[model samples]
Target: MVTTGHWIDSSWKLQKRVLSFVHIPPPRRGVEISDAIFKCLKEWGIENKIFTISVDNASNNDVAIRLLKDTFSMSKNLVCAGKLFHVRCCAHILNLMVQDGLSQIVDITDNIRESIEFVNRSDGRLLLFADIFKKVFPRFRDREPHYDCCPSEEDWVKVVKVCNILETFWATTQIISGSDYPTSNLFLQEIKRVKLVLDNGVNDEDDFIRAMVRKMKTKFDKHWGECNLLMAVAAILDPRQKMKAVEFYFPQLFPSNEAQENISKVTTVLFEFYDEYVAANDHDH
Candidate 1:
C-alpha cells in the first residue's frame, strides 16, 4: 500500500519527502514495481537529482535498488549520485529484537494469540476487559485497546520497551481476571517469560526488563550516526524541534551494526579528506 510519509530537513523541520509511492501487485514480479518507480522518477527528473535511494534488503527491494542504480547513472549536477543506497529503519531493528526475543520460545506466540482470542470471542468478556482496562489505563479510555492480531502498521509499533509491554500485559491480566477467565494466570506467566527472554537472550540486565531496554538502546545508539532516519521520524511524530542533525543524516542509516559503523567511519574520513582536498585545490589556484 502506498501510504504517505514525510521527511525532515537540516533545521529539524518536517517537510514532505516522498514524491511517489508504489506497491507491487499480488503474485509480485521483481521488475514491475521497480520499473514503475524508475519510470516515475525518470519522468519527474527525481532520478537525476537523487543522491541516494533508501530501501530494504528484502529480495525484491534489493532487486529494485540495484535496478534503480543501474537505470539511473550519476548526473553531473547530483552529489554522490553513484553513492551507496542505505537500507534501514530503526523500527525495523526494534522489530528484530522483539522477534528474536519471542523466537526463543514457540509457545509465547501461540499464547499471545490465545489471550487475544479468548477476550475477542465473547462480547461480554471483551466489554468487561475494556471496562477493566479503563480502570487500569484511563488514558486509553478514548478508544478500546483491541489487541492487534497481527500488527501491520507502516512502522510496526516498536514494543521494545519491556516496561510498557509488561504494563500492557498486566492490564490485560486485570481484565482477564475480572472476566473470571481460567487462562488469565497462564497468560500472565507467559508474559513474564517473554520479558525474561528479552532480558537474558537479548541482553544482560540486573532487571530483565531494564536490561532488554538498555541493550536495545545500546544497539540503537551504535548506529545513531546513520539510523538517524528513525530518530527523525520519531521526532516528527513527537513534533520535537531537536534531532535536526538526525534528519540530515536520515538517508544514510542502515540496519546492520557493522555496516553502519563502517559507513559512519568512512563518512567521517571522507568529509575530512574533502576539506583537505578543497584547501589544497584553492592553494593550487
Candidate 2:
C-alpha cells in the first residue's frame, strides 16, 4: 500500500492518507518496488515534492531508494538532491536492538510465549488455566481471571526486570511513530534516553540484566553509534531545544573530544540549508 502524508504548518498536524496500492505479483525486486512508489507519487501529482521515505531495515530497501534517487535526478522538477530521500525507520531499528537483548533470555520468553499460545488456542485449556489462576490468587475471585503458564520465582523476577527495561524503548517507539505530531525533533532526546537506560542496565546488580544489556548495547552501538544529520538538524531547529539539545546530548553521544567538532558540523549544515531555503523564497518572490 502507498500512503502520502504531509505536515500542516498552521495547525502543526500530520495528515496521512492512502494514495494507492499497486500490486506486483511474486519476486518483488527493488526496482519494481521503486517503480510502484514513483507511479503512486506521479498519480498524486507530488513526484517532485518528495523529501524522505521511511523504510524498515531491509537490504532491498537500500536498492529501492537508489533506484528512486536515479529517477528523481532525471526529473526537471526535482526540488532537492536525492541523497537525503531515504529515512531508516526508527521504530524498526529500536525493535532490532530490543530483540537482541531478548535473545539473551530466549528460553524464558519462549516458554512464556508457548504457554500463552496454548491457553489461547483451546477453550478447554483456557478455562482450566483460569480456574488455577483464581485458586492461586483469590483476591479477585469475582473478576475474570487472566492466565499464563507459571514460571519459577527466579525466572519470573528476571522476566519482570527485562520487561521494565524494554518498556522505555517501547514507549519511545510509540511516541516517535505518532501520526498526529512532528517526530523528527524528538529523535535525539528519545535516543539519548535509550542509551542512558542501557548504560545503567549494564551496571545492574543482576547478572542476567547486565549480560542482556551488554548484548543490547552492542546492537545499539552498531545502529546508532553515529548521529544522523537529519535528526541533528531537526533537534537544532526546534525552538524549545535549539543548540542546547545538541550541546547537552552530543557529549554523551560521542567521545568528549569529538563532541564539539560534531556540533560545529551540524551548525554548518543547518546554515547551508537555511541559505538554500532563503534563496528559493527570494526567487519565488
Candidate 3:
C-alpha cells in the first residue's frame, strides 16, 4: 500500500509527496492501516498539517478512515471537523461504473474474446481462412450450440460504439490519476465531458446499448451525485477558474434545482476554510 500527500507549498504552488509506500501484511485491519499512516505522518512531522485523505471506495478503506479520524481529532482539530476528510478516488469510481455497464454486454464481449482467441491461433491460418471462412461459417454454426459463441457483424458495431463512449473516460482517467501535475483544476471540465458523453448515449437506438448506458449512468449518479468539496475548492482557488468554473459545471453535474444550491454550499465551505486558516495564522502570531 502507498500513501501520497498533496498540499500547497509556501510559494503558493501545489506539491505532491509520497509519504510512505509499504508492504502491508495479511489480515490488514483498520487499526493496522491507521498505525502505518500515523507512523509516516509522525516521521514527516506533518501529522497535524494533514487536511484530507483520498482513497478508493473499499470497505477496508472506509474502516481505516474512521480509525484515522478518531485518532487525529484527539490531537489536531481537522478542517470542517473532518467531515470531508475521506475522499473517494474518482478513477476507482469510474472503473466501477465501467464494470457495471460492461456486465450488460457480456454476450458481445464473450463473442469478441473468442474471435480474438481464434485469430490468435495462427495469424497465417487466419489470413488463409478469411476468404473461405465466411462461406463455411453459416453451415458450421448450424451444428454448434448457442453456448459456444461467435462474433457477428452487429457485435463488432456494438464494440465500436462502446469504445467511443469509453474514449473520453480513458482520457479523463489518465489526467486525474496522475500526481505529477495539478489535477484538481481539471476536475470540473473532465466531469463535464463524461456527463455529456453519457447523456448522448442514453438515447442510443439499440436496446442493449441503451441498457448499458443506463447502467453506467446509475453508477455515475451514485458515486458523483455530490460534487467533491475539496476538488471544487481547488478549482475555485485556480486563477483560470475561480467561482465561474463551479457555476458553469454545476448545472451539468447536478439537477437544475440543485445546481445553485450546491454552488452555495461550495462557496460557504470555501469561506469557512479561509476563516479557519485566518484563525490559525492569528494564533501563531
Question: Of the pair 1 and 3, which is ahead by lDDT?
Answer: 3
Tell me the TM-score of model 2: 0.85
lDDT of 2 by residue, 1-285 (tens): 455556465666567777786677667778787888888888888887777788788877788888888888887333335434677889999999888988988888887786677567878766766777644322222233554444556777899999999999999999898876789999999999999999999999999899999988998887787667778888988999999989999999888878888888778777867776787689656
Quote each prediction's TM-score: 0.46, 0.85, 0.85
Off by over 4 Å in 2: 9-13, 74-80, 119-150
* RMSD after CA superposition, every candidate: 14.2, 4.3, 3.6
Model 3 pairs in collision: none
lDDT (Cα, tens digit) per residue for candidate 3, span 74-163: 876789778668889988988887888778778888876875565557766456446556544443345434324566667778889888
Rank by lDDT, highest first: 3, 2, 1
Clashes of each: 1, 0, 0
